[model samples]
Target: MLNKLMHSPSHKSILRLLRNSMASTTPMAHLLHDTARQHWRLLMLYLLFVLLLSFSEACLFATIYQTMRLLLGAPSFTEIAGFGFTQGQRLFLLLFLISALQMVASMSRAIAGILSGRFAASCQRSILPEIHRYILSLSYGCVSSFKIGDLSHQATLAPLTINTEIDERIRLLTEGLLALIYSLVLFVISPWLLLMAGFLGFCIILTQSWLRPRIRLAALAVEQQRRNISGTITADLQVLRLIHTNACQEDSNRRFANEVEVFDQKLKKLSNLRSLLEPIAELLPVLAAVLLGTVSWILSDQQNGLLIPGLATFVLALQRLNIRLAKLALSLNALTENQPRVEILNQLLTPSGKIFRRQGGTPFSGLKEAIVFKNVSFRYSSRQEETLTSISFTIPRHGMVALVGPSGSGKSTLSDLLIGLLSPTFGAILVDGKDLQTLDLSSWQNSLGVVSQDVLLIHDTIAANIAFGSPVVPSPEAIRHAATAANADGFINRLPQGYDTMIGEHGHRLSGGQRQRISLARAMLRNPEVLVLDEATSALDSHSESAVHAALDSFSHGRTVLAIAHRLSSIRHADTILVIDAGKILERGTHDELIAARGAYADLWERQVHGLSRPHLHKQL
Candidate 1:
């Protein structure tokens, strides 16, 4: 049966789509369908209410039409069985019963709203946390590939937007079903009028269909523009101090304004198309009502007996039918409008073979012997040049190794390899005689610590930021001890709130030296077996650097330390110094030995000693 389906053209297309959905992100239809299936009992209950509401609406409209007929004095056409009352009394009682039924229908609708709202909230609760967890689980490369703005939108805003859209679509679906029932009743009243109204509805649908591609394109454009705008706004805010210092605020403002203008233009185009759709959806329905009423009156004149009653029924039914069709059209428009955002969310949430983060390897313990890079090479997917080339080296257990090189010479790339952030493209990294690939990275990471140039702190208490990744929050004494080791406790104690002081965004409230020390304290808090320091103290003043170095000396006694720095003063006591140039280690020796040898490391040392700075000389001096 599966083979036959695969061979059939129509089934092949469906199979291909299913395969695509499985391999990549699920399509919107599948997402909705899956969500509905998860809440099947509640959805079914909601639908029952919707059905009751629709039935009540049909009954009430029919009752009104009957009441009009009896009051207009067209008697005895289709009398209620066993009711012996006069037409006036019959009409009054019937209207009263229909009014009560209408109230019941309203109450049912209210109940359905509660159920749907709860279901929608549940969907949000499920999807938001899941997406956040998935993001955290992604490989460092995958995480870094997305911008902060884009990730923020995906994690924070997209779930809410998607849930709201889901609610709207579900509501629309129920309304559409209700409209169908109304259309059926109208068809029974006057087939000709019903057919004409359906023709108008079909035209409305056709117009929306024609506008779909354009609107969808516009939606995509707007979504992209929104990301760009978000990125721009974020970038501008982050660089505001630099812009002001350089006296380029006008230039920055103009650039941001231009982006905003472009976004505005795109929005205008989208709105124009949307507005065009609305009037067309609305106008045709009104025309249908006018034409149907006119036809009913003319038909009433041609038919002598019971004409008023029939005409009244047809007119009321047509009115109800028009309402349902109009609502259906609007629902479709809303779905189309939200397509781009949904697609963006789908891409973020989708787990694809090509993009999935690697998982499930042998659990790793702390490094016992050494981390060895054997003939390691790496090239980014977007670049032709290899960033690291045959970078063979061994970081001995419980040793301090300094990587000294200019920018773009693969110091950070090599560090990334050491941290298991990037895997070797053409070689293997071994830890304790086992391939890094075989070791559980998460476990390995837990045993590792890092202090980099840019320290990231959340807008929370200092203690929280220092104890960010630990499964359990560090105790106050532990926090104080780590801070003392990092030479940060003195200043932390001086703060208004002491250890409980709230750090502003990225610890902007603190000085550069303070932030760096706090970062060091964070690294120390983990008591990592392996520590990587990439220009960790470059922001510190001389006194602060000395204090931090003293703290690090105590911490580095038994830990494997991989330090990357340009300041020759800091690594004077390193056990081993590797001087890298153009993706290869040209020299490796102790600080004193490399100086005596007068090689690449020697040249860098001399330059730093003389306060001469040359970033990267392609040719050896």
Candidate 2:
């Protein structure tokens, strides 16, 4: 299957990606190392507490073993009881002391585990935002190159499992190390059990040789199944409303069930492997005990080689070591299986040097300046064909410009460029004639307002959705005012809870027009110098479109608005209309000039005036 995966292009890409990702670990390791170096004091304190817990456990086990031997191997119960005291009070006091020590060790170990959990969770929480920022900051083309489900899987689940390794594996590893030390201390007191423990250790190593990789493979399958399930779930959930409304519920159910069944089977196999492990491991110690018991009985018959009263102590300590070693092996397998996902996540979360962070994000030379595309060109990374070919145009300062074209035209491509979602392949983009590369990317984007045809609203309260990630918090008054400007206030006020009402899963609770208006309101509240409307009213009915256009006209009056619209009527009023087709501008003019000239605009206008006309008919009037 792995060789077949290597042959498949999609999975083959993952292999190549894995190599890049392996190299990528240098920075993340450095990040972890740097953090450790800076917070060595805290780390040392954490280690100290863990060691204290381990030592306490070791001491309790040792004491218990010794007490058991005294009780069992002593010539008489009276002799054992009389060693330290003359009456029953002596044994009672010894029993009480042992119980108290055991309780302290158990409680402290649990406390240390909790502390480790909190520390791991805190570090995980800190790493989360950086991961989110890295994924969010990636270029749109780069983001589109992967499945959305895969990225989300890498972002959330992968980190969670890797953190489990830190929280649990390191803790288990240390416990085993401490137990081995305790075993050594026991060995110092007796030779028979020491030899027996060494023989058991060898047996365990042989058992684990095959056991570890099988367990790791099972775990790997579990993780792979989860990613597939996540992708399927994400894609289906995105259009769940449409699926149910269109009576495709059964189809959607089948898809979900298919993913669930596959994931469940993988999980079952992994669980089965884990179930089989400890039984096989138990054989290691049982075999060791049989051999040691036989050897000890024969040695006891010899005059010089004698049986010790503390034989039970060595046996007890050796048993504890065996148990912990088995657990350590289990943890090591889990860590190895999860390591690949951690590697992939490190790649997704690593920062790219391409985006330039502002030193301080100072104001641009002209915040209110127009945008210019000086011979821009772009093609999606996955596509061989160019989407835009040497496109050049400028929006007049504080003026309205509309990009108009048919399907597959460069209108949307140009919109992408104007919004800085994609950089030009060969030419410079400018704001106030300053190279865009010179300005801070995030700050520059913050200064722009965009309402696209694909109206994406979060599943949150209406007011919260409008506020979104506004740098300045949106007040009730501000939110209401913005909603009114987008002509969404009236409808929103009539909802059961008004602005406090939750949109419910991608705003499915609202109509299409309602969703679009909320998006418009969001952009309006920003009060940006550059307003991008990519078919803002295209999704609305005529009645709703009228309301939206009125709001848009007011918005366009003050700001530099660049609109890409299919409706020719909207662009007829634009100060300049660029007739774009097949990635190049066919013409650029005012409404009347293009109409009289009988260019591409005139044909589109004539065709619209008559009725919907296909572009296959003619190029112009």
Candidate 3:
């Protein structure tokens, strides 16, 4: 009968109503539904246990009612003619039923606890990986918009919030079911009293409805403030050296304190709103009980002896129902509080909210002929002007090319295009007569090595940093060879721990030159087909730079090198040189040829050679 009732149309309608309501109010509802579908069998078994517990509690209450009647000298049960049982036998039967109900309730409670834990674990196992995968799938441009701290919070905290939301929803459902059962039992005993309780429940619902919007607003404010504090801390840590050098510790502290104060104020406001829910939920039920008792007292003259036990059973059922109602209220409050986090997470997971890189099916083995940038034009989304305009260049296989330009003259942007980090807005980049977009990006990128002005080093052993992205783990000899070629081996060997010494975050423990050398070593370990160096030796002193240049002269014998340099002396021996200014290529030829031509490149070289200031050079250009 219970199974049939569950499969009935009314039951399906109730479920649909619940789903629609949750979907309209919070984005977490869809996540919860997906998680439920993944673990439906466990969820069904858990619900079954909850139902059994509710039935056991009702049976226990029935036994209590009979015991109360017998103790009050009231004959509530009809005597069966055939069995003819004595009062003592009846008492023994009630005791046996109560014991059986208690035992069933205890077992069901334990099983429910175990199932809830397993379900939570299952959710974490599935949801966390999905979150991470989505975050990784986002395009570089999209990811750059988010602060590291904010993104970290999304990856780490948002998935946990989903699990918490699931737990709260489960609790809400369990309490709601238990409350419904208790209400039915109460209604069977006294319909008028049940009506009074329903009215009080309606009042509580209205009060919650008024408070919920305010709570949600406060919770959103708290979440924003918290992420702001996280972003501020992350930015400060990344520039800790700058802060120390400038002696801005006091100002930084004052700013951080102000942020914390705002965060605390918002948090307290949210807490106060949530705290208001419990007392109101608890108080309304008590008032309903009082009203019921007053009505019963006024009608005492019309009641019989059986009324005493019936009334006692009804009040007991109402009290249990009130407990469940209070718990349900708290669960609802928790769900509302976490709704903002769920919305943010949903935005991250949803494809419409992000830009994804376009991928192709063809795998890139190796570049054979050349990388041709034909009429390439590029612009950032935030900027109206083009960063690279009508740029045409070719990086031939096993040939050396260099780009020279003023600051913000699209040199790094060109390297970024070559690295496949940005796509051209107008023209095509061809690889071996095929469109660069037609080949697999990961394969293309894996075959190239890049060393930028800002060196990227992880907090690990020196050897680990050098061999960070190698396809296979490098042997100790190979690591030493790469470090030696980059002129990093001497300082590394001088350290007490040699290659095993731990570098602090971003290699903060190392000097600027040392960090740059380590970065070069990382690139050297790859033995790439095409090497891109954007001011790769800017941090190195003259002696180290000369040594690295000699090493590169040997390394560049059979490899393609695209070098972007500001120091004219570094690229004077290149096979081809391009001078760029204001997103346009002003001159392209050999360095000596450009010097002989006495164009922009020669003018810039003259200024650098005589140590002229940039303001004068900009004017001359």
Backbone atom clashes (below 3 Å) for every candidate: 0, 0, 0
Please write out the lDDT profile of model 1 over residues 1-621, one tens digit for every residue.
111212223223222332333222254444544454455677668778988888888777777767766777654334746557877678778779778988988999899889888877777776677667768777887788788888877677655655656566666767887778778777777788778877887898899889877888887898789888898888878877788899998898899899999999999998888788767876777777777777777765455446666666666666666666667666667767777887787677555632445587988877789988899999986689999999888889998899988888999988888788988889999998999988877888888889998788889988888888864578988988998999998999899999899988878899989998889999999999999999999999999999898888889889999999989788888888889878998889898898898777777777778855345532563
Which regions of candidate 2 deviate over 4 angstroms?
Answer: 1-46, 57-97, 301-308, 350-362, 365-370, 469-471, 612-621
Cα deviation of 602 in candidate 1 (Å)? Answer: 2.1
lDDT of 3 by residue, 583-605 (tens): 99989999889989877787788
TM-score of each: 0.90, 0.85, 0.91
Stretches off by above 4 angstroms in model 1 are 1-30, 74-80, 86-88, 300-305, 350-354, 610-621
Alpha carbon lDDT at 209, candidate 1: 87
lDDT of 3 at 237: 91
Q: Ranking under lDDT, best-scoring first?
A: 3, 1, 2
Candidate 2: the clashing residue pairs are none
lDDT for model 3, please: 0.82
lDDT of 2 at 378: 84
